[model samples]
Target: MSSRDDTDDLRRPFRHTGSWYKMGSRQSSVMDSSVQSLREGSVSVLFCVLIVALGPIQFGFTFSIFGSLSNVGAMVGALTSGQLSEFMGRKGSLMIAAIPNILGWLAISFANDSSFLFMGRLLEGFGVGIISYVVPVYIAEIAPQNMRGGLGSVNQLSITIGIMLVYLLGLFVNWETLAVLGALPCIILIPGLFFIPESPRWLAKMGMTEEFETSLQVLRGFDMDIVVEANEIKRSVASTSKRVTVRLADLKRKRYWFPLMVGIGLLMLQQLSGINGVLFYSSIIFQSAGISSSNVATFGLGAIQVIATGIATWLVDRSGRRLLLIISSSSMTVSLILVAVAFYLKGNVPEDSHLYSDLGIISVVGLVTMVIGFSLGLGPIPWVIMSEILPINIKGLAGSVATLANWLCSFLITMTANLLLTWSSGGTFTVYAVVSAFTVAFAAIWVPETKGRTLEEIQSSFR
Candidate 1:
């Protein structure tokens, strides 16, 4: 093995003057030329690294912006998502949404420079923003009252599954290949949209009576009696439509305000609980928890979330929304408190001591428990509740507001989490625990159970 002196000697750049005085003329010339070549080579390498480090755009802060552009796009898309869905039918909106997603992925895949990559991310974000709102509303409107909770829960389950799939694929594939794959689902969706039934409620609201009935019949089966459900949808839509067009002031009404508050509050709190920050920095968290294989632990966390969300899907309809939310939030509070205490204790213990290792394990356990608790309720139910409770008249505009609040909170949390963690891991977890504890009370007192209730029935409860 080389000592520090030897390593330093090896690294020292070649120089001509001193050695050349004793060397043959030809050897001296050759040495001097080689040294010049090495100097130029080093400079060239640094220039290339600078270019790469600045990202394909090579502008100041562009690299950071590149990573966050998608979120910005998503926020814009969310702002308009309700309007787009209302303008076009659910199926139509989804088809339109898929176009940008496909194009975005293609742009990303073929990008030689940063502009295409940035544009692609923006487009993808926009498409996702629209889909996020429409998909859940469509599911809630189409599903049978008995099965609505389970089906609505699937929206979140599918999200967790997609996230897990991306993580797994990312392990082996290049980013370009992954981008191409990212577009595939959207591409397939374009054609599939043609065959699926449009949301019956949407059709009803549009006054496409024949199409609404047809769509409902298709979803419920021609053999099933559709009269009861059809009438209920018409009555709900008709009554809401007759009121003056909802303005910001109209939301002050209890019917409008209560459900909207609950929906937006839950969605915002979901983000405030710092789920994204935790997941985003899971690797760092695991390392701090004394896990040797942080990557595996991260993947394990994703898998656990997927499994827990799946269980939530199965339990949602049977157990009811409010109960699950209460349980989920309460469990999350406890888990986060455990994590906070562990982090606090770890700081006081010597790193080499047994107590340090035990504290680390406690942190790991607390984090896992928190993830499970989140997956069971906070992750999925808020969207379900949002879709269920909002009136059809204001759903597009109001739902957009709710969705926007969620994305905004998500951005804030993602941006600040690192700073908070840097300040104090224990303190960061303590803040999250407090938020989760508040969510428990919010869900219990304010959030309604929409399980086993028709859309009209659920909306009526808000009135």
Candidate 2:
């Protein structure tokens, strides 16, 4: 080789700028970029995850609110979250959501009358309703495909953690103190948004090309080569941007209609399985089952849920989404059946009899198993799938529709749970059991495997 050719080969391995040594070869650069991108993506996703995750915590915390009233407020928010997200972008919408949450918690903390409590709950519900749709959508938009499912699972994990925190705190502190504590997450989240980049996909979709590349770079790492990924996002955005506006009529196409149906179906089954009802009146269920310490049992239930959801975060990407849902739904079906059987047996046995005591123990076991089954799969996976399956063109409107369906079902279940229990505990559980069984069939038949797929790839699968 010539002298200059030899020097060029050496330079190809390493480039020196001042005191810094940078990789010169494409292979080395790509490797380094991937590592740095992973790190940057982790940090960026962590903040986004923390901020949006708070919405679920808020959702769980506000479970103390009375009746279907909070659901009414949440329904209103769900319907409007799409417009808010479209107008202000994802980060801005979340910031706006945080304001109401903070204000709502503050109102609850100082409340002497029912009006303040009710109003506070309404505000809190509205905020979480927006969060329920936006956070998952934002996370899906920003996350690298490999990390998306795991990060998306964090939303549900945060919710389980929030529920446990409130339940634990309720054991020690006054309601006012708990309300103050509830506001703290949003207080932290509002300023944290300034540190994180806006969703690059959102920026690209809005035609802010320079900002889109910049945000994507920030997310992928300053030193990383984001050109390939950037182009992919731009292409995805460009394909949808031609339409400019998404209307309900566009949903008539099979590609749009199928995914929308999947999103709405999973959410509908999620509520119809009676999770909220079980959670809302867990104490009553335990008491009726003859548990001496219903509070302790409730606390245990929260602990189990948190632990199971945490395990799910680790498993989601590795195991994929559909398998977990099937397992979760099937197990929940069995557990609910066990609960129903226990309830039926308890009703038949005399209170003073040994059989009654045995039935009580069986009921507790069944309830705990039901919770474990739920946390294992159904609780987190549907949201992950919903966020994954929707095309960017219709994400805002379809997300709103799916979320509205979720809250609507939640309202119906919550409203009827107590009455159903009054009529027959065995019957209520049997109904939930049947619904859980149907979930298994639904997941097996329709839900797609989304692991290791890009957003564009996922959308393409439907077509």
Candidate 3:
């Protein structure tokens, strides 16, 4: 196991870029705290609905129209947003992202052909990717330090919920209906604009003291020691400036190279885990394994993903980063091997020959295990670790690089999975199996323990 040593909190002191009190004599506690009422507000509920409903419009019907474009767009968005949010600040970037989301739903619902659907999906994917990148940064910045992990996780949680909700809706609703539903979030986002504060850290750095304080109070309420936290924020931000912004020169520096490497590794392992093949095309994989039923296997795979992700949410914090990755990676490796073996066995048996096609049960077992293993380890860890460790100055750049790697890998894997399945039924899955085993070794040796460590501390570990 990698070293799991306790280290001092690595939060650098904050220094607001502009600390002038410019936002209406500092919003009163009542006004400032209003943003915190997201749970009670109709707009907030609508916001959740908007996010969750995107599944249908952006992701309905598996591999066909919505889901494919959505995934690609999101990858592009995540990579782009990583850079955009850093420079534009988290709030403005997120607000801008909402447009395409709304547009996508409209186009998909109204369009007549696959071309319109594809265009809409492309737009939706771009917006979704932005949300995935920006939301975590926003949430992490808003929450009090102790609550950051729990709250930041909601970003990913919303996505999982969104995906699952789309799957459930597909049980009955048509894609057209789902496309209309996806628009709900865009409309709701307009109202949410009135609330959900600009990230305090972002505002503060931009030199908006009053806005920063107001954003903080809105999210934190009166219970937290605002004065103390504000001061701490100042110190942290100040320390960051001393390190200088990331430049090409910084890239050449030996001190920062390890994190860059880790970033690449994180995204590489994420896609290499054989997750996309199972998620986007589990029904197909099931059919290949002699389980010809689409409806049953798709539902089963989705259920497995949900269950495994639920388990991962619980275990990730407790098990810590290193152990969870090792275990999850190892389990995924074994399960992939099983899947490949099963596929090979089926490939050898002539379809015309009467054989027990009931291996659906066995295929389900193998796939479920692999999915569970993925949920527990590489699925969540890559993003979490990357987000947790990357330094603030270059956080967006590094995240973009890593996420770009993920998208490329996903595209390659998905494309290859299809080509290989067509070219050699037994071979592509074998490659995926090898990839999974290699991921186990990567997690075991290269990845480090990041549990409970502050972002700066984790960054230092790579050094």
Candidate 4:
């Protein structure tokens, strides 16, 4: 084949411009093929990164052991998620995760004392920790490349929706009823697993060739020709199988470390920006800000997050990852600053004065805007980028490190938010605002635009 033909083949899957290119020479084709195969390892490594990349809200508070214990459980679960998925397969791991969630919720529902409540909360967090990683990875593997971003964003959108549901339902339901409600989703998921196919790449990696092909066929639709995609997955699995065992020393290399750094940095910074603090303690924050209906305001905040995240889902593929991140981070910085200023003014103004109520209004608007900013890019894009960028050989270890970092940051932020608010609300938001400002710079300088790029193309850019 002509050089042009070979080049076209390399570029076919990713039509957008990026850092890597291929020459038509046979030598280059061979090298490219090797890299392509490695990139294809994305199928197996996808869940690995997702596990590390998607540390989400195990909402923390001081109200009970529930707050800190859940995050502790999630940290533990995140640590184990990669191995569990590897040993049990994606479907098996999810089933394992669901059991804890169901039992935790039930335990919470019927709790007679703090011990049961704590146990249930911890179990619930453990289940969420595993599910957070596995579900996104599952979605990333199964989704068509063209639809990946939109579908990936759905993961965050669902989290926002769940938060909203909880806030909205808290008004009408007793805590016991809400706990029972929490169990229902997992209960429903248990049986639904039977209907879905396992990750084809995983099957391929495990040397279950026929099963891999069948799963791919089912996922892509029975009528579709999966021959090309199937071969790609097989090559990926084959190349990955031959790679040397990854070690801590391997991280010294730029190609190995850069993507991991990006993944960990984005996730850690995401939590440090105090999104969870705002979420877990929004009721108290609103009340202190002089809102008449703190519960209603909290619910509204959740609703806004859902709406913003939905918009993000629609825009992720269209606008690209880097752009959304920059926009999102910038908006968050400004919104946080606005909040800090409002809170500062609240201290200086008299409660009965017009300025105090105006400051409250400003605080509300700023808080809402910050949540919107987060849901748009900071919330979902980190997972998508991590799934796309991490090198396959180091995926598991790197993923675990990243997941641990995220959950750790989440624990620290959520655990301390109430104290910080009491210490000085203005000071708390000021810290978050500064972190958010740094995130804007980080997104602009470090985060790559993964939109419309194949995993191989993305990884190659790091080289």
lDDT of 3 by residue, 278-344 (tens): 6666656677666666666677666666667667666666677678878887887777777666666
Evaluate residue 164 in candidate 2 and report its C-alpha lDDT on the 0 to 100 scale. Answer: 85
For model 3, the superposed segments whose C-alpha errors exceed 4 Å read: 1-62, 65-68, 144-147, 226-229, 350-355, 358-360, 459-463
- How displaced is residue 336 in candidate 2, in Å? 0.3
lDDT of 1 by residue, 417-449 (tens): 888999999999999999999999999899988
Count of clashes in candidate 4: 1
Candidate 3's error at 52, in angstroms? 10
TM-score of 1: 0.84
| Model 2 quality (TM-score) | 0.92
Candidate 3 all-Cα RMSD: 8.2
Tens-place lDDT digits, model 4, residues 309-350: 989989999999899999999999999999999999999999
Candidate models: Cα lDDT each: 0.77, 0.84, 0.63, 0.76
Model 2 lDDT per residue over 389-422, tens place: 9888778888999999999999999999999999
Poorly placed runs, candidate 4 (over 4 Å): 1-65
Tell me the spans in candidate 2 whose CA falls farther than 4 Å from its real position.
1-34, 63-67, 244-247
Alpha-carbon shift of residue 315 in model 4 (angstroms): 0.5
Q: After superposition, how far is residue 340 of candidate 2 from its true place, in Å?
A: 0.3
Residue 107 miss distance in model 1 (angstroms)? 2.8
Better of 2 and 3 by TM-score: 2
Number of backbone collisions per candidate, in order?
A: 0, 0, 16, 1
Task: Return whichever of 1 and 2 wins on lDDT.
Answer: 2
Q: How far is candidate 4 from the true structure (C-alpha RMSD, Å)?
A: 8.4
